[model samples]
Target: MVTIKDVAKVTGVSPSTVSRVIADNPRISPATKKKVREAMEHLGYHTNIHARNLVAKSTKAIGVIMPSSADKALQNPFFPEVLRGIGSVIHERQYSLTLSSGETEQEILAEVQRMVYGSYVDGVILLYSRVDDPVMSFLQERDFPFVMVGKPFEKLQEITHVDNDNFTAGKQITNYLIASGHEKIAFIGGSKDLFVTRDRESGYQSALTDAGLPNNDAYKIHTEFLKSGGREAVERLLSLPVRPTAIVVTDDLMSLGVLSTLEESGVQVPRDISLVSFNNAYLSEITRPALTTVDIHIHELGAQSARALIERTVDKTVPSRRIIVPYNIIYRNSVSEQ
Candidate 1:
């Protein structure tokens, strides 16, 4: 088995120098580094990350905590797109990524604990934020280096988070509906437990208030982020007396189900009921009528969270950061004038 010692001997440098070269210590001269690396390649000396981690106290890896099980979360295109963004930065930094996805909150917390206690990764990126989240509490109590992709339930000044201005986004999109002559507008969102949904919903209500439109409680529906959730929300809305003229859905995935269900019920999109959604997922563009939605820049959110967490891991004393990625509206055929 090739070892650092063999490379050191061939390169005529001490084993310590070989180790330093492996660590890419800036103190080592570039010429010496080049020579050592050439010898390492020639001798087939591959680094054992386990040993290196033991010495440096770093795994050179980051853990990504998904909000739900992989099978369920990946059904929404948002997850894949965000992961691609995170992966881009991770790859550029020459770091590895570990995804921790569990079926429930408890299971997810357990996976996070393992990642931290077992020294599996240098830091973690939480993909979702919940009110009074045990996972967030655990990371806080341990003073573990981590970042969230959504607003924290509390301690906004202390926890590092990357998110869009969802409140403003919601209001802007809702205002667009109102300007298009939609007086009776309804809202469909994910679980109220998520701050994203709550903030967006708040903005939606605010828009209605400003426009002097009644913010009817019956017009608001909360469900899961899946297409099935959209389908379910549509069923409820359809049952309402004097149905809304337009709807604002919090997720593109849910909007897909909403469109399908509305069609199945013999309701034509735009012609009968207009819809606007969040997250300009790829499918949004290919749908029959396409979709008028908010482009929350899901990829940028992931990239920023990973970058922030990496910075925190490198220097634990660095102050927490709040990164707000900008968002814009993607106009499509889903919305029409009432």
Candidate 2:
């Protein structure tokens, strides 16, 4: 219950002087500032951020918006890696990170509305971008300062985003598998609605076409961003009479699931079917057969998103930015020549 007044009384300075010290006004004499700070420490004083926010019209905090249905995908290593990157910048700027996640679109959009109208955060960062997303529509409608972590399905010129060159990643990984002597390659990706999935799938197909490899419709599969999703897709694909000689999965976690299903079915990787995937996440190297994956620089994606949002918050007139982080393929023991 000790107030600024208590610090002012103890420090023998005016209440305004204590207030100026708390705000780091720089106008206060250094000697007086030191005494006021010491008195604040002795009084266990904390500045009222809420009151300051009212005056400054900013909370100095950023709200992160996860995918509408990220309950499962959020558990993946990608989110945490990106968060580390986002934290690196936001913390340096003395801003706090707040998260908004929900299992449904309505729930997620509602949280976003609360953040926007309630003045809870100075900016928002969306971790996923998809086609026809309501939350995105709302943000666009409000002209709120926000940044997306992936390509916007619409309003490309209006939305600022940071994304990986997933198409090139898909093509490079696919090309690598083909060069290693695998022809009958299958692709396992996430939901079709996701920009990431469609871009990667397009790249995979382009590589197949350029290499004169058969781009069989049956070889392409889409599933949830979950481990079981990989298991289920592989189970179905393995039952095909013309099984693929190799697989190009879109995510490392799903690749792990595919590896699990292969083990349980007595199908040896590389020896039976070479595998390549993306994300280069933590689990990729630890499996019995280390996976060859595309390193999409997940952390950079987050950092750039934070940097973009902070920039927009500072100067709303800044032109929208589209940052594409680079990717590279990491070869390991997962693939062998067919």
lDDT of 1 by residue, 1-338 (tens): 67767888898998777766764544579999999999877766656545545676998899998889999999999899999999988897788999877989999999999998999999999999998899999999999999999999999999999999999999999999999999999999999999999999999999999999886999999999999999999999999988999999999999999999999999999999999999999999999899999999999998888778776775576667789999999999998888
Clashes of 2: 0
Clashing pairs in 1: none
Per-residue lDDT for 150-256 in model 2, tens only? Answer: 99998889899999898888888898998988889999999998999999999999999999987699899999777888999999999999999999999988988
Point to the candidate with the largest lDDT. Answer: 1
Root-mean-square deviation per candidate: 6.9, 8.3
* CA shift of 112, model 2, Å: 0.4
Residue 228 of model 1: what lDDT?
A: 100
Q: Enumerate clash totals for all models, in the order shown.
A: 0, 0
